[model samples]
Target chain A: MKHNPYAALPATVENIIVETSNITTFTFRPEEPIPFKAGQFVELSIPGFGEAPFTPSSSPAVNDVMDITIMRVGAVTERIHALSKGDTVGIRGPLGQPYPLDKFKGKEILIVGGGVGLAPLRALFFALAEEMDHYKKIILRYGARSPGDIVYRNDVATAWGKPKVDLMLSVDKGDEGWKGNIGVVTTILEKNKLSINIQNSVAVVCGPPIMMKFATIKLLERGYAPENIYLSMEKNMSCGIGKCGHCRIGPYYACKDGPVFTYDRIKDEPRIWD
Target chain B: MAKQLKQGCTINGVIEFLTTGCRVYALSQTDSNYHLTSDEKWESDRHMLGPHRPVEPLKSILFPPRQGVGRLLEDAPHSSPKPAAVIGVKNCDLASLKIHDYVFRDTEPKDPYYIDLRNNTLIISCDCSRPCDVCFCTAVGDQPFPESGFDINISPLPNNQYVLESGSEKGKKALDSCSDLLEEASQDAMKARDTARKAVYKTVEEQAAVKGLDGNKNYQNAVTGSIESHLWERFAEDCVECGACNFVCCTCHCFLLADGRSATGTSERVKQWDSCLYKNFARVAGGANPRKYRAERLYNRFDKKFNFFKKVLNIYACDGCGRCIEACTGKIDIRDVLKEALDEA
Candidate 1:
């Protein structure tokens, strides 16, 4: 029988983690292991509701279970937020292109994520942590709306803040008990005393469209080549393959050609921020 | 070998002969236009066999408006589909079918449902002896007659007989089975068929030239360059968002899949036709819509037809059939849009 690309594999929710009031992480053990790269995405479906594309938040090295971090936003996501352990759901793919970790070797990797966009970067961080010795430096500059919006707090505070890995955290606003830097994530770039070798450094950015637009400008102003900066693009996608034209951005189909594309490759396309 | 029916044979005789073995679908005349109907008897004096394309494109018969992609149970019984023969297919619709074949069957992981329907059906194409005012197949590098991709091609002669030619082995077999109803074509009939085909091409070419839609310029480059053109906003001003143009288009095959559950706890994923002109076509889960404005959506529809599909599939998604022009409630003519966007620019 021919494989139906739209058919979802039966999966059982193995675990659930509440990362924030609106964001939750659901772990599922599929009928088969969906081996994927750290930056790829999957279509998670709640059967009768419909399917929505999400990037896995857990390490790709962990094959037995997959973790998808979702924020309660629309109809499909509201249903996903209500899902608990032992509930049945469906998974379609480990779709789209992954980050080029091979190209990042022996170079300083600058990973910037804001809000729930940090989920895919977390997966990349875990993958890089496994091979920490392969690179000169690994830096993560993450920001969220507030301190309560910070995800993977324990890992960010301890595991990712080792001597070799420079971890910087900020928020748009702070509570009374908060003592960290209070500003948008880009402010950390201005406040940091560390200098990055622009010739040997590559930046990966994922966030809200506005954040991405300004962060890309900051990276370019810091002397990073357009080709050296990668951005994860999201659009309304169906048929995770290229058949459905929903995710199309100019000549590129975000589902097939990319959810991850270098800045230089798509700089000419219109309305990237929209 | 080319075959011919007698000089006085009516369209009803042909329909009866074609429907003998299996179901036959043909164009039946309606008040405004021709609609596909399965009624065997030719009830209307105004009904035509083959001169013009129908109001509905052939894609509706092959890939239905709504179809089941997945069932709740693994072992659900699927009924065997009845083999069908569709007659009066115009060359523009055939060209669109070629594009659809590249998308659904030629690509990786072929769609089983579309493949099943395609394999079970026989295509009977007919020549366009009369080109409509809106028809512009000549502008898109397509002829008013079928060049390929047909089971049987029927060319109408001057005296009402048809010169039937076979394009595939299946067509040859069908022709052979109906030998008793047909006769060997005469040289006079062949000459008349050639004259009629040439006349139709001339008419289409003259019409296209008058409208400045001769396909001379590089449409792909012009459309790609016009991303921010003010013309799109003007077009959006009159568009009602009824999606009638998309519904009547020959190659607008975008679809949305949803899972519907029954009270018995069984669910099926149903795929339904979707239009990019709709407001929510590109709206994502988190309310980020790339093509949010009606102007942007209008621009996207033309871009997909003229630019993106050509880049990916190496063929324009549109066949210049003009059904969209006929179906548009606002009377938005795509030929005029192309001329204004590509030629006038």
Candidate 2:
């Protein structure tokens, strides 16, 4: 019998910190910190229950303590919700390609996020924040189905108040106390004064497949190069590694080559938006 | 002592030597087609040699179907060791084994059981006497005989003698241990091996009539638009997603991890074979299948073959072993499907 590497890892869960209504953040430290690039995801499991892949909501720089924000829309999430701090679960990886933050050096970066897609972008956000002086500018346009669906709302507020980061929030259906814009994430981009130069600007977009399509088209219309638009793809990935045939879009493994890919690299693949 | 008639060892002598203690699996001819089994009663005059290069290759005997991948499960009882020898291994399967070696035998370390099985087993390869209609080893620049990655490679020789060559150190040892049956070969015996191999090579070349189709640069394109095309419905319309094609595949290495409680009441993780053809292969827990349509599921098979497999491993996933066509209850031919895809372009 072959000794599987993933099963050998401690299936011990650290603590389940419920971050929001639809989301629970799992905080667990692997015996060895999985040194990974931001935007990569790990296969989180509740031994004998089920497993799912999720990007670490925490920064990549924080190797010891890793946080994975999961939405309560599936079996694994429901099991994860039943747990509290110090419950044991299994975690495998820090898998897949990370954000290309190196490409954004000395360039103005625009992060367009919708719903729980903000989890991965948040890693990139803090990574950039640590080296704030190196970047020219950082702008974030975030939206969800409602104001409640938005994650890291308070973190975005602090980052916005820091003066170095410009942040905008929106919702599809605004409630009575809503003072911010009431529109899609695309509308927020159109309303903003975004300078999209082909040479020195990158827009990292992640959302539902429909939002990703329109947001990518909108970014291209605003002078962003096809190669400059990075989209974090959310597909059903079981392994979070190249071995599993799932999460494959053409020549690339969404888990390994990318959950993050430039539009130019994968534009020719069929049904990619879906 | 049993009489040894050479030109490839006498069929009886080889079987007699193999059945000592080792597990010997060979092709047994039933009424119509040949099946591989160890049941001595079912054994026929049919040799271990494979005639049709089925799309279902031989990767499964070594790699588990769907098993625990990265998860470490509590150790299960190691399967009882039975030293074995499988004969009539082909060239395309041999080539794919090299790719498998690279994947599993990483310097950083990987697949301990896979490495052990490959290391321990004695692989006896023989020359292909005839070529299947879908056989294209020559087109891919592969020979019909076992050239590399074999233990003992046997070439049919004239005058009832087999030209036996030691392919690996294990083969050398295996041959050395069988000193009573072995002898110093003359130049004529070597010449006989060359003639027999060339005859098979010529047959393979004639069979692979689709010129310039060997090195498929269009594989990426075939995989890219495969999902959107009607070809999936056309080819896989009758496919039941039975997973036979994947199970017998030489390179389909996807697996699933399961946790089971031991008789000792301790939980253990077990890795088992997985097939992409299954309905739930890509389904998430909430029932949102990104590839819900049959077309998308069928298309992923090709994508894994041409796109994902090639990009990561730098080798074609399909080794030109025609096992899938042979195993398909639907009679869907992969060669025809691939050719149609390339032609429609």
lDDT digits (tens) for residues B93-131 of candidate 1: 999987678768887657777887888888888999787
- Cα TM-score of candidate 1: 0.93
In Å, residue B291's CA in model 1 sits off its true spot by 1.7
Cα lDDT tens digits for candidate 1, A142-171: 889999999877878887787679888899
Clashes of 1: 0
For residues B186-254, what per-residue lDDT tens digits would candidate 2 score against the true structure?
777777777888887777676655533554336566656555668888887888888888877777776
Error of 1 at B161 (Å): 2.4
Q: Candidate 2 versus the native: TM-score?
A: 0.86
lDDT of each: 0.83, 0.70
Off by over 4 Å in 1: A191-194, B5-21, B39-48, B72-80, B176-187, B263-265
DockQ of all predictions against the true structure, Cα-based: 0.54, 0.33
